[model samples]
Target: MRPMPRPAEYGQWDELPDVPEVPTSRMGDLAVLDVRERLIRLIDRRRSEDARIAELEQQWRERGGVGESPYEVSRQWVRRQTTEGALMLAGILDRLLRS
Candidate 1:
């Protein structure tokens, strides 16, 4: 079987522009630090959300076999995780943009 082409190999990679270095000015330094900190927090929150979702899925799977039931516990778990993650992302974006 032929290997599928990755999106990056197909010229689909979108790189973010690099942040310019701030001079020794106090205010500029503070602003740069704040932006860097906010970016770190945003990444950490996203990682936390991903980990929580993964844990929930693992727990759901370990619950037992999915028999002939109509309602799926894993599906419900995923729905809740997605909603919560979206809410968290909104808060993160608000903080990042407001700063």
Candidate 2:
């Protein structure tokens, strides 16, 4: 096996030491707490909405809503709901950042 060459042999004597990378936090303490609260509230609201939707569905099924949907949900309704949900989340983040 050949011997390894020294770093000084290549005219390199002053090599800088390795530096540790500092992790960056996106949100400060206040903002982080606010975000956590908002997220918890959103989660609670979603849970309530889920329960209400389940109850309504059970009632609908009990009423013999079979074969086809009478008042079928439209694409616009779905899009609106999706957009509202996304916007609500975005609004929360925006508020958190603004504060």
> Pairs clashing in candidate 1?
none
Window of ten residues with lowest summed lDDT in model 2: 13-22
Per-residue CA lDDT of model 1 for 1-99, tens digit only, reads 424333334322122222333444534555456765555554465456556756765675678736432233333333344444445545554454455
lDDT of model 2, residue 6: 36
Residue 78 lDDT (model 2): 31
Tell how far residue 36 is off in model 2, in angstroms: 1.3
Against the correct fold, how does model 1 do in TM-score? 0.40
lDDT of 2 by residue, 1-99 (tens): 423333334322112122122224643556545555555564555455546655766677789887643322322233334344545655666555555
- My TM-score estimates for the predictions, one after another, are 0.40, 0.42
Local distance difference test, each candidate: 0.46, 0.45
